[model samples]
Target: QRDRFQTLAEYYRIKHGSIGPLRSWMDRHWTVSRDKIETSELHRLIVALNFPVIYTTNYDRNLEVAFEIHGVEYVKVANARDVSKARRDVPYIVKFHGDFDDDSSLVLTETDYLDRLSFDSPLDVRFRSDALGSTVLFIGYSLSDLNIRLLLHRLWQTWSRSGYEADRPPSFIFMAHRDPVEEAVLARWGITVVTGDDDDPEKGLLGFLSRLAALVEANPSDPPTLESGGELP
Candidate 1:
């Protein structure tokens, strides 16, 4: 039965019965070799979009590297200490799932997730607050990620209970293809699904981002700041 575990967390739980090995595995897998990262077209597009706040569940520092390579000053907050030290002048990269460089900060197993939710950790609190206030754009994720699905579900539940469902800010997800059933489910959560062309998915993504960048540039506005803003670090 121990060998039958399906999830990463479950697999690790059975193998080590602790988070140490999982932490090590993540660190080894996610840590980039170069001090300066080579940015991807997607990463460049994200930087070009100039989103005020970006939240990622990934533990890798690719996004941070992208910002650095583009000469974009950004503050990263992954835990309570980072949150307390986060600066305001620059844009924010909120690492909701912790980072590879910091093992203690990493959230791996089911126990870790439950602990984060139960304690209402700073990351969770900040994410909920940001979700409520901002127009969320989810990229680089799929419905196959149960963790993301559950998180979205919780957010939807919260908004539905707030009694201002009509006034909620719009959220979006970009995907390569559309699933009718999934689209309907996402729609119920107030998240619009954006899909790429069936034949040329990569081109579709590029076109969509290019248009988004143009729009942002044409109608420039102050980027969203944290609730407790401070000077740039």
Candidate 2:
């Protein structure tokens, strides 16, 4: 007889018997450093947009590396301690999921995801605060995660409750392919769905980001008020 694992958490739990080994494995292998980061045109385009704060559901440090490669200074807020170091003058690269350096902060496995649902964690609180006033732009984010959908819905609910949903700054999501169901739902949630020409998701996303970058570069004195909100899966 053989055992089949249906989920990543199940596999890791059975293989290592606990969370410790999984995190150790990531720490030993998945901590992608700046020099180790390969060239990425999409990343270059995102940085060029100059979003004040970038939030990611990714566990790696690729975004930070992108900023470093472009000579852009960024404060990485992976945990509570890192939050104090954050400044308004420079860009903020926030790790909403977790970070390689901190095992406790990593939000992997089914358990970690469930724990974040309450939205009381420091990172979650920070997001709720920043997102309230900023014109957020979500790039390449998937709607599969319940956490993200809940977060988006709650953000809308908060604004609506304030009787200022009409006054809320517009937020956007860039999708490579247009889905009527997704577009309509997001629209109802006050998020405008933006699409591009390319049918291929990666190409479409790259094209979209390239256009935004060009717009920002052309108007340095009055760049678009965009902020980082990506999930590079």
Candidate 3:
């Protein structure tokens, strides 16, 4: 989550303004899977829903590849400028973390995280706007990333504090494996928790998405509205 990214970002800022070295470091230390089913599922769901997705991960280009494999056109956001351009495209994948191909964009390390804290860059405005408008679905994320959590929480608070409707917060989804403890924390902030069997998340997600697509198809004339009355119609 936020803390993990912040830690990586901070480290990247100090090490070389990039996590170029961390790749090697992780390979030497961590025993993690480079192949993730969820990554592929991410692309499948995106194509199924025809929705743009933004990801924040200090990992490889698995997401991008997933899109390509599905024959879904996609664009990567390397900087702020890509945001507007991607917004106009068929489908866009915004990488909040630096991509593997670009070492400099990698936000890893304690210093890098701290530096990004003052996200005074040009992309800040675009990030804020997109976050406000979209229904964000968070998957493969842990609640322990305090920095990321803080950023999200602050964004929600800022929107509310600026005299917007108190109940009209942006929609967010937490695809959970087993209702982690963090679900409550996210719920408090208006994030909906979706728990499915972790071992079969792909199938579960696919089923859920299929039903959602049908619902949208069935209600094309109505323009979906939540009974909870949060999002604007």
Candidate 4:
């Protein structure tokens, strides 16, 4: 039987003792040219959102390539030192999970996930700080991820104890499909659920992002998202 709980990378590490070979394989196979990356609608839609900072758990250079291909300026932040390189003029692409460029930073193994669960890493701290004052819209998350769920609960708990929950800015989750159970759980955390009906997950995400992109093109301003500023607990 296949182990369904742990990620494939974690499984490989447990069985073979190291992910060196796997990482090398991915480096060779996952690499793409800037021209090719520019064609991806996922990249285009994301760039169009024009947020000051974009956070993603992905390790690849997809976002960076997309920004370059689209002629948008962006800085990739993978660690504390990179944070200093970020400027206010361009968007910041934060690699929340880790990046391929840094082997020590990749959150591919089980151990890495456990570490992230603590939610005290430099990147996590940065996220918590930014989220406290910015509107956030989470897409491409299953919400089944324990790390993400715990993070959400922590945010909710913070607002609840702040004696200003009502003043808390709204947060949104965009899902391909709606589940009553998931919605109910997230609702208590003050996260609004949005859905798409395109049948295909990629298409569904594209549709939602397209709308946001359109809205941005019409008005050069912040796209409607969950506002996060409330008095800190």
Report the lDDT tens digits of candidate 1 across residue range 91-168.
899888888777677776666666765538898888888899888878878687666787788889998998998888
Q: Is candidate 2 or candidate 3 better by TM-score?
A: 2
Rate residue 21 of model 1 by lDDT: 68
Write one digit per residue (lDDT tens) for candidate 2, span 1-233.
01121157656876877667776776668666555454778778778888889999777778888888998998999999888767879998899988877878887766777788899999999998888887888876777657788998999999989988888888888877778899888888988777766878889888777777776777788755443332221
Regions more than 4 Å wrong, model 3: 1-21, 24-42, 84-87, 167-169, 175-184, 197-207, 213-233
Q: lDDT for model 3, on a 0 to 1 scale?
A: 0.60
Better of 1 and 4 by lDDT: 4
Which segments of model 1 are wrong by more than 4 Å? Answer: 1-25, 32-39, 117-119, 198-201, 222-233
- Highest TM-score: give the candidate number: 4
What would the per-residue lDDT of candidate 3 be over residues 1-233, giving only the tens digit for each residue? 55665565565657685455766665355433345634555556656566655655645666566666677787887666676566565666666766665666666666656677775654556677766766666666666666668766877676768777364544655463645566667666767666553468667666556556666667766535433322212
RMSD (Cα, Å) for all candidates, in order, is: 7.0, 5.0, 5.1, 4.7
Candidate 4, pairs of clashing residues: none
Which portions of model 2 miss their true places by more than 4 Å? Answer: 1-7, 10-18, 27-38, 224-233
lDDT of model number 1: 0.75
**Could you give me the TM-score of model 1 versus the true structure?**
0.80
Q: Tell me the whole-model lDDT of each prediction, alpha carbons only.
A: 0.75, 0.78, 0.60, 0.79
